[model samples]
Target chain A: MNREKVILLVEDNPDDEALTLRALAKNRITNEVVVAHDGLEALDYLFGAGEHEGRDTSVLPQVTLLDLKLPKIDGLEVLRRIRADDRTRLLPVVILTSSKEEQDLVAGYSLGVNSYVRKPVDFVEFTEAVRQLGLYWLILNENPGRV
Target chain B: MMDRLFSLRVRVLVLVLLAVVPAMLLMLLSARDRRDASEESGRARALQLARSVEVDYMHRIDTTRSFLAPLAQVFALVPNLSNVTQTACASFFDKLIANTADIFQVGVASTDGTVICRSPAGAESAASVAAEPFFTTAMNSRAFSVGHFEFESVTQKPALHVGYPIIGPAGTVTGVLYAALDLNAISTDLGKTADPSVSFITLITPTGTILARYPNPEQWVGKEVGTPPSLAAMESGGPGITRESVSLDGISVVSATVGLANAGASEPGAGSISALVSVGIPKDQVFAGINDRLRDDLLGLLAAALLAGGLGWFGSGVLLRKLQLYVGTTRRFSEGDLAARAGPPYPRNELGALGRSIDDMAVAVSERQQEIQRLNEGLEQRVADRTAQLEAANKELESFSYSVSHDLRAPLRSIDGFSQALVEDYADVLDDEGKQMLGRVRAGSQRMGQLIDDILQLSRVSRAEVGKEEVDLSVMASGIVDDLRRTEPHREVEFQAAPGLTVTGDRRLLRIALENLIGNAWKFTSHTERPQIEFGAEGGPGKPVYFVRDNGAGFDMAYAGKLFGAFQRLHAMDEFPGTGVGLATVQRVIHRHGGRVWAEGATGQGATFSFTLGGSS
Candidate 1:
C-alpha cells in the first residue's frame, strides 16, 4: 500500500473534480491520487515547489492528469513548467479537460504532454476514458527511474 | 502623336515651307522660260547687229557699180579706143574715186586677157587679164557682173572685184570694166556697232570661207569658221536667224546669218554676187540674264516664305495659347476643382468658335461636376450614417448570438444532465407521468439548443466575408443526399441533381445553403409514397436559377410568404421533424451571397424552392 504510484490531478471546477474522482474510483484505480484544485498546486506537487515545498524532491509522481481551464494558472502552463524542470522533464502527463475547444488540446500536447483526453459530457464515456488512462499510464507505461 | 520638339512655331514654319518648296520648284520651271527669253533676245540682238553691218557690205558694191555702169557704156561706145581715150576715162575714174574713197581702182580689160584701159593710167599691166575671174566673168556677160573676193596686187589688201562687159557697136563684148573695192572698209563699218564681249561679226562665203570679221579682224579676216550651218544658211539666202556652233576661235557660240542685199543690182542671185554677213556670241553671256531673274526669284520666294511663316506662326501661337488655357482648365477640372472654367469667348470663326466651344463645354462640365460633388457628399454622409447604424445593430446581434452560443449552452447541458440523472436514479420512485415530464424537458432543451446553433450559424453567415470559388453544386448536392441516405438508410429516396451545375461563390456558405434546401426537401418529403427530390439549375430571366423540387407535402400558397421565417413551419412537428429555422438559414446564406430565394407550392402539390446566385437577377 505504501509503494502505490503517485498520481497528480489538476482541475479547478468542483463538479468536474468530483466527477473525475468518481470515474477513477469506478475504474478500480486506487492509486495515491493527489488532487490539485488549480494549475499552481499541480505544478508545485510535481516540481516540489510552492505549498508542496519541503517534500521529498526525489519522490516524483508517476503520472499527471491536467485540466486546461483553471482559476489562476492554466493546466497547459503547469505542464510547460514541469517539462521545463529537469527533475520532472521526463515525467508522464495526460491532459484531461471538459473543453472540446481544438486549441486547448493542441496547446496541451504542444507543451510535451503525453496524452490529451477530453472529459466527456456523458458520465459513462468519462468513466471509460479514465479506465483506459489509468490502465495505460499506471501499469503499462514504464519509467526507468520510477520503476 | 506630335512630338513636343515641334512647337507651334516649328509646325507653322513647316507648313510655310510646304508651300515654299513647291513654289520654288514652280519658279524654277518659269526660270527655264527666262533662259529661253534671254536666248531669243540674244538671237534678235545678233540679227540686228548683222543687219546693221550688212548695209555697209551692200553699199560697197553699189557705189562701184553706179559709176562703173555709165563708164562701161562710154567704153562700149569707144570699144576700139586709142590709149588717149583710155587715159581720159582713167582720169574720170580718179575723179569718181575722189568723191568716194570706198572705190579702190577702176580698169578695163579686153576679152584676150589684156589690159585695155586703166582709170589712173599705169595702175595695171596692159596685158591680157583673162586669168582673173573678174576679167573672165566680164567677157562672158553682155552688161555687168560681180566676181569673188581676192587680194588685189596694188593694195595688198583683201578686196571684192566687180566687172562690166564693154560691148561694141555690133553688140559683141570687147573689153571688161573692173573695180577693186576694199573689203577692210566693210569690217571697219561692222566694228563700229559690235560689242566684242557680246558678239563678233563675220563675212563668210557659201563654202564656209571667212572673207572678213570685226573685233580682231586682222586675225580672223580670211579663215574658215567652224559654224558651217550658218554659212550654208546664208549662202542659201535664208532669213536672218541664229544657230549653235563654234566660232573661228574654237569657242562655243550661236551664229546668226543674213544674206546681204545687193546694191542697185536688178537681181541679187546674179553671179551669186552678194556677201553673207553673220554674228556669233557665246552661249553663257546670252543666258546670263536668266541668273539675275533667278536671284530675284530667290529673294521673292524668301519673302513669301517669311510672310506666310510669320503669319502662320503668329496665328498658331494664338491658337496654341488658347489650347493651353483649355488644357489647364481641363486639368483643374480633372483634379476635382469643380468651380474652374475656361473663360473669355472667342469671335465667330472655326478656331475662334472652337475656343468659344471649349469655354461652353468647360462651363457645362464644371456645372455637372459640381452637381456630382454635391451628390457624392450627400451619398457619403448617408453611407456613413447607415454604416454606423448597421454597426450598432450588428454589435447587438453579435452579442446576442454569442450569448446564445456561450451562456445558454451551460444551462442546456445542466438541464439535460439533471433530466438524465432523474430518469436513471429516480426510476423506482418516478411514475410514468413524472418520467415523461422530465423527458419532455430534456427534449425541449435539446431542441432549443439545436435552434440556437442554427440561429448562430445564420448570424455567422451574415457576418462572414464571401470567398468565391468554382463550386460544383451538383457534386455538393450529391454529397448532401448521400449523407441524408446514410443517416436514414431505410428511407427510400430518389434524388436527381443536374450534372455539372457549377457557379462561382463561397463553397462553405453555398454548401450550407444547399444543405438546408436539400435537408428541407428530405424532411418535407417524408410522407410521400415515393419521395423524389430533384436539384437543377434552369435558365431564368437574367441569370441561371437553381431549384430544389420535391414530390412532398407542400404549404398553402397563402402562407408561402412566411415560409422562410425563423419559426415559421409548414408542417406539424409530429409529421415533419425540423427546427423550422432551416429555411431561414437558407435565406440568410442566399442573401449573404447577394442572391434571392423564394418558394412556390400548393396545399397538396410538391414544393419548389428557387434561387438566383446573380444578385438582383
Candidate 2:
C-alpha cells in the first residue's frame, strides 16, 4: 500500500462534489482526495502550476474522477492535456459525470480515459460505484510507480 | 415515298410536263394533216395543167385534119395531069397556107411517090416525098395520117406533118396531099396560158419522143424519152395521172400526164393516137407554201412550250419558298426553339392555312413548356424552404436534448444524494417515519432522474444518424431476454424467440427498437404465475412484420392507441415501473427506418406489439 496514494475529484457543482466526497468516505476509501472545482484547477493541482505552484510536480493522483461539464477548460480538454504530458499521460482517469450521453462517453474514451462511469442519481448506487472504482485503481489494478 | 424522295420543284415540273406533252402531240398531228393536204393540192394542180395542154393539142390536130380533108377533095377532082392543073393546085395551096396560122407548108405527091405540087416553094420543093412517113401512111390506108415531129424545109422549125389520100371518081386512091403544122405556133399558144406552178410542159408522141416542150424546148424537143411507167395509167384516157419523179433536167417534180385520142382520121376505125401531154411542178414549189406555215406553227408551239415551262419553274420556286419556310420552322423547333413559327405573312391559299395551323401548335407547345418550367421552379423552391425549416427544428431539438442530459440530471442527483445522507447519518435522532420520508424523497428524485434519462434517450434516438447494416432481430431479442433473466434470476419468465428474423437497417437503431419492445413484454409479464414473452415475425420477405407478445398485465383495447405515445401509460406505476417513454423511443426508431408500430391487447388477456422495418427482411 502506498501511503501517499491520492485521488483527484474534478467537479464544478458544489453539491455534486460534496455528494461524491461523502460517497467515497462511506465506501471506506481512506486515500487523500484532492478536490478541484473545475477542469483548469484539476490541471493546476496535477502540474503544480497556478495556485498549486511550488508543489511537487512529480506527485500524481492515483486516479482522477472527471466530470464532463466544468468551469474553465472542459473535462475532455483537461484529459487531453493530461494525456499530452509525459508525467500524467498514463494516470488512471475515470469519468464520473451526471451525463449518460453517448457523445460524452465517446469523447471521454477517445481522450484516453481509463474508465467512464455515469454518476447515478440513486445515492446507494453512487456509493457502490465509488467503492468499486477505489478498489480497482488503488489496490487491484497494477500501476507503474511514479509514471 | 415519292413525297419523301422528290422535292416540291420536281413535282411541279412533272405537272407541267403532264400538260405539255399531249398538246405538242396534237399540234404535230395537225401539222402532218396540213402537209398531206398541201401534197394533194399540188397533185391536183399538175393534173389540171396537163389536161389543159392536152385539150389545146387535140383542138389543133382536129383543125389541121378539117383543112386537109377539103384540100384533098379539091386535088382529087382534077386528077388528069396538065400544067394548068398543077399551077392551079399550087396557087390554091399557097392561098390555103397563107390564110392559116398553124400550117407552114402544103404539098401533093402522086401514087408513084413523086411530088406533083408544092406551096411555099423552097430549094427542096421538088424533094422526093415517097420516103415521107405521112405520104407512105396516107397512100397505104387512104386516110388522114399524123407524122412524127421533124424540121420543115420551108420553116426550118419543128412541126408535125399530116397527109390526106385523095379518092378518084372510080373509087380508087389517086395521090396524097400533105401539110406541115408549125409546132412553134402550138407551143406559143400553150405557153401563153401555162400555170406558174407548172415547171415544164412536154408533148410526147406514141413512140415516147417529145414533140414539143415549153421551157427550154430546144434541149428537150426531138429527144426520145423513156416514158414514166406512171404514164400508162393515162392510156385509158379517163382522167390525167400525176406522179412524183425526176424530170429530164433532174429536178424533182410531181408530173401529171394525159393521153390525147386520135381525131379527124379519114377512116372511122383508125387506131387511136396515144400522144401524151405532161406538166411538171417542182417538189420545192409544191411544198413551199405549206412548209412555211408548218415552220411558223412549230415555232409558235415551241415558244408556247418554253413560256409555259418558264412559268412552271418560276411558280414552283414560289411554292417551294413557302414550303421552305415551314421546313425551317420545323427545324428550329427540333433544335429546341419552341418559339419558331411559320406564320404571320401567310399566303392566301391552302398553304397559308397550314402555316397558321403550325403556328398554333407552336404557341401551344411553347406555352406548355413555360408552364412546366414554372411548375418545376416552384417545386424546387418549396423543397428548399421545407429543408431549411426541418434543419432549424432539428437544431432546437438537439440543444434541448443536450440540456436535459447535462443540467437536468445534476439537480436530481443532488436531491437524492442529500436525502440518502440524511437517512444514513442521522439514524439515531430520526424516527422511522422521518427516515421513510427521506427514502420517499430519494425515490422521487431518482424517478425524476430516470425520467430525464429516458427523455434524453428518446431525443438522442431522434437526433442520431442512422447507419445501415444487416441485423438479426430474432438474435437481438434473445440477447435482450437473456439479460432480463439475468437481472431477475428468481422470476420464472418463459421467453421464446423464433430464429432467422433478419432485416437490413441501422443495426444500432434496430437494436434499441428491439430492446424496448421485448423489454416492455418482459415487464408486462412479471406478475403472471407463468409469465410468457415471445419474439417472432409474420408477413412475407422484404417486409416482415415483427412482433413481441406477452401474457401478463394487459391493458384494455380502448387505450391501445395511446401505447406508443410519449408519457401515455395505460398501467399505473405501482403495477409496472417505467418512464412511459420506452415505446415512444421505439416508435421513433421504427419511424426513422421508414416503418410503423402498433399494439393490440384486451384486458386480462395479453398484448402484442407489432412493427415493420422499411423494405428489408
Candidate 3:
C-alpha cells in the first residue's frame, strides 16, 4: 500500500526540478512522483481543480517535498492551505530546498512540515539524501492513508 | 567689602539712624537757641528790676532835699532865729516828721557842732554834729550832702543822713539842717514794685556796704557785701551791669547792678556819694520752664528714635527671614529642583507680595521645565519611530538575502550536480580535457556555494541578537579543536587552550567567533612541521584580550588593514584553501559583542589573532 502511495514534488526552477528527479531516479525511489511546477499547481493537484479536474481528491501523497520559493501563491501559503483542509491535514510534508535560512526552517516547521532537508550541491550527497527519505517514508514508516 | 555684614537688619538700622540723627541735632540746636534767648531775657529782666529800684532810691533822696530847701531859705532870710520863729519852726518840724513816714529824725545844728534844735525832743542827741560827714560836707561844700549808710543807735536800722548848709547874712555857713531817712522803709516801698522773679533787691554803698536788702533788711542792712562778680560789676560804676553769679545768700542768680545818681550834688566836688541798686533773679528760675520743656522734648524724641530703630531692626529681620526663604527656594529651583516652591502661608504686606511673585516665577519655571521635558520625550519618540522604520528596512533586506540564499544556491547546485552527473555518466563521449573542464565547472560552482554560505553566515551574525551567558572560551576552543581533529585524525596538531578561560557574552555568537578564530589557527597551521595552536587571554576580567596563536603561514603586517575584510585572503587558494570570510565572521561576531578584533603577524613566522569583548568580557 505504501508503494502505491504517491510523492508530491512542488518546485519552480526547471534545473532544480530536473536535478531532483535525477537524484530520485539514482536513489531507486520507484514510487510515482507527481510534479507540480508552482505552489498554485500543487494546491490544484491536491484538491483536484484547475488542470487536474475530474481527478480523485481523496488520494493523498505519502510525502510532499515542498520548496519554499515558487512562482505563484508561495510555498508557505500552499502549506497553510494544505494544513487548513481536513483532507490533507495529517499528510506528511517535507521541506526540500537550497536555502538554510533560519526563518525558512522555522516557518516550515511551524507550518507542520514533518521533515526538513537542504538539497546538497553535490549530486552524490543529494542522491543519498533522497534514498534515506524514500526508504523512511515508503518502506520503513507506516502510511497514515492505510489507517 | 563688608557687604555680607550689612544685612537687611543692619541696613534698616543705618537707615533709621540716618532719619533720627538730623532731627536730634536740630532739636539740640533749637534748644541751644532757646537757652540763649532765655538767658538774654533774664539779664534784661534783672536790669529792669535794678533800674526800677534805683528810681525809688533817687526819689526818696530828692523828696528829702526838696523839703529842706524851703527851710534853708527861711533860715537864710533871718540873721538869727528869734524865739517866736524858732518855736514856729519847731512846731512845723514836729508836724512834718509826724506826717512823713520816710524821715525818722530831723534836726538843726550850729557849725561849732552844737545842736540848735531837734524835731523830736525826747530823743538822745549826739553832743557834737561836727563829726558828722553830712554836716561837714554841707558846711564845707556849701551844698546839700548825703551821708554814708549807717545803722542808727536807737533804731538799729540803716539810714542815709542828708544835710543842707544854712548861709548867714555875711555869706558864711552858720547852721545846718539834717535829716536821716529810714532805709528799711525805702526798701519796703521798692519791694512793692519789684518783679516776683527777683530773688533779691539790694541797696549797696560805693564801699560795698549793704545799705538795705529787700525781704530781710535787718539781717543785711549793716553787713558789708563782699565784692562778688556782681559787686565788682556794681563798683565799676556802669549805668547798669548784669552778671551771672552766686549771690551773698548762696543762690545762683543772674544779677544786674546800677549806680544811683547823687541827686543832692550842687557842685562837681559834691558828687562823692556813690551808691548802687542791684536786683538778682535765681538762674534756674529764669529758665526752668524752657529747660523742663526741652528735657521732655528730648526724652520724647529719644523714645521715638528708639522705637523707630527697634522696629527697623527686628521688623526687617522678619522681612529678611521671608526673603531668605524666597532666595533659597529660587536658588534650589535654579539648581534643578523644578518642584521647589516658596510654599504657602504668605505675609499680608509688600513682603508677601514679593514672596508671591517669587512663587509665581517658580511655578512658571516648573511649568517650563515640564514643557521642555515633554518636548524631549517627544523627540525620543520620534527617534524610536525612525529606528522602527530602519528595522523594517533591515527586515526587508534580510528577507531579500533569504531569497538570494534560496534562489541563487539552487542554480549553483544544479550546475555542480549536472557537471558531476556528466563526468560520471557521459565519460565515454567526453575527452579528458572536456571532462577536466566539467570538473573545473563543478569546482567553481562548489566554491561559489561556499562563498554564498559564508556571506549568509556573516549577514546572519550581523542580524542576530546577542544573548549573554557564561561562555568558557577555553572549553569552546578545545571543543572546536576536537572537532577539527576528528575530521583529520591523522594530523598530529598540538593544541594548547588556556585552562578556565571564560567570558560573559552571547554564548552562540561567542562559540561561533571562537570556532572561526581557532578554526583559522588550525587550518593555517596545517602545513607546519609540528603545528601548534594556542588559545589564551591577557588583561583583566571583563576587559581581557583573547588571543588565538598559530605557528603557520602568517600574513604580512603591511596588509594587516585588509586582514579582516570579507573575501580577503593572505595566501593563495592552492596554498591555504579558504573562503576568505572566516576572520570577517569572527570580526562581525566580536563586534556584535561590543568588542575589538586585530591580527598580528610576520610573514612565514607565525600569526596571532587577538580580540576583546569590550567591557562585557
> Against the true two-chain complex, what DockQ does each candidate achieve?
0.06, 0.61, 0.63
Report the CAPRI category for model 1: incorrect
Candidate 1 has a DockQ of 0.06
Off by over 4 Å in 3: A1-6, A39-62, A71-92, A110-112, A131-147, B1-14, B77-88, B97-101, B204-210, B216-229, B232-241, B246-251, B259-276, B292-381, B615-617
Per-prediction TM-score: 0.52, 0.67, 0.85
Backbone clash pairs for candidate 1 read B90-B119, B113-B128, B113-B129, B113-B130, B114-B127, B114-B128, B115-B127
| CA lDDT of every candidate | 0.76, 0.82, 0.83
lDDT of 1 by residue, A98-140 (tens): 4544446677778888988865445555678999998888878
Higher-TM-score candidate of 1 and 2: 2
Could you tell me how far off, in angstroms, the CA of residue B572 lies in candidate 1 after the best superposition? 5.5
lDDT of 3 at A33: 87
Sort order, TM-score high to low? 3, 2, 1
Candidate 2: Cα lDDT at B258: 76
Query: Per-residue CA lDDT of candidate 3, range B1-617, in tens?
Result: 12553476787888888888898888888988988888888989999988877777778888999989988887777676433244555566788889887898888887786776766655565677788888888988899988767776666778888999988878988789888898888878767877677888888777778887876776777787664344455444456788887877899988888877555555322244367787888989988977898889889988988999988877877777788888888888889888888887789988788888888998888888889999999999999999999999899989889887988888888889889889888999999999999988988888888898889889889888888888788888999999999998998899898899878788878888888888888888888889999998888674778899999888899999998999998898988888989889999998988889999999888899999886364
- Candidate 1 ranges beyond 4 A from true positions: A1-147, B1-14, B48-56, B76-80, B85-92, B117-126, B168-174, B193-198, B207-209, B224-227, B233-241, B249-252, B260-274, B281-288, B306-363, B380-617
Candidate 3 or 2, higher lDDT: 3
